[model samples]
Target: MSNQIIVTTGIYDAIKETLRRKKVSIHEEKRLATELRNARQVLRRDLPADIVTVERKVTLKDHTLDFEHEYIFVSSTREKLKKNKYSILSDIALAVVGYKVGDIIDWPFKGGNRKIEILKVEAWEE
Candidate 1:
């Protein structure tokens, strides 16, 4: 998709700072850089509430499995993948980051493609 991914200015800053100071693989650096280059940044107050942003608690349904799952989108420092806390830097989360409620996100995973429909997005209280 050619649509620009929207990122809150706060999130954008955090990601940018992380990229600057953290040591990561070239591939990861390229991915993060691409996100910044292609993003549309906005102030936190202007961020659409339905969209999945940092620290948002999101509920999604797997179209392939007919199963529901809940995850708290966090920074990589805080993610515990199996526990449903997804790092925004992860491939899965990155692919789905700008999605909003009712949006279908399709991404590659493991050995095949996976699809999930966003059911809800609860903005972070802090």
Candidate 2:
């Protein structure tokens, strides 16, 4: 895979700011940095519908676990509730955001490295 990813300008800035304000593992930090390094930034209006972004319901297939799960990628903790919501700062959300459908990524989590595949993405609302 190429070392390039596509992300909206807003999402990119939010990720950088959130990372600066939070304390995360060095491995995650490095992964995020690498993911954003060659990012093709686009305006919100130009962001592809298939791309994962904040407030979007994303379906991820965990190759290591052999299961699939859906999550609403939220930009703030306030958006999270009992539902299947994932904060942008969380390892899973951070790893999947900015990626498009069919894209598979290996992310370093607390447990170990996991291969996550982007299966679907859809807009969501409160």
Candidate 3:
């Protein structure tokens, strides 16, 4: 009696395993890159810069909020008005009256600058 054995190498199995590992590594690298980019953006946005600071103490009934900070005003059209216009502080106060500190806001007018960060809010009268 003679014993005979048959063995074969699986090309498909090897390729599948290699592809699976590569896919996992690619996904991990992408996730890490996204996290790093997000951290950098947050740092850049929060850090203070050299600009004009306009501090305004806004009072509405009994509530008061101190808006003190420097901001950049970008407008496409800078037209001089015949009548005197509202100051930047007054415009910001009107836009952010009901908002609280640490809230992100966006106010878009015909031609206006957007203001962020209420800073501090207090309750007072007159």
Q: Which portions of model 1 show Cα errors greater than 4 Å?
A: 9-38, 81-83
lDDT of 3 by residue, 1-50 (tens): 00111111221232234345553244433432332233212132332222
Model 2: colliding residue pairs: none
The collision pairs in model 1 are none
Cα misplacement distance, residue 35 of candidate 2 (Å):
1.6
Query: Considering every candidate listed, which one attains the maximal lDDT?
Result: 2
For model 1, residues 45-117, the per-residue Cα lDDT tens digits are 8889888887898888888778997878988888887778888766556556776788886655544567878
Better of 2 and 3 by lDDT: 2
The 10 consecutive residues of candidate 2 with the worst lDDT sum are 75-84
lDDT for predicted candidate 3 compared with the true structure: 0.30
Off by over 4 Å in 2: 1-3
> Is candidate 2 or 3 superior in TM-score?
2
Q: In model 3, what lDDT does residue 19 have?
A: 40
Task: Give the winner by TM-score: 1 or 2.
Answer: 2
Task: Provide the TM-score for each candidate, comma-separated.
Answer: 0.68, 0.89, 0.27
What local lDDT does model 2 show for residue 123? Answer: 89
| Runs in model 3 lying further than 4 Å from the true structure | 1-90
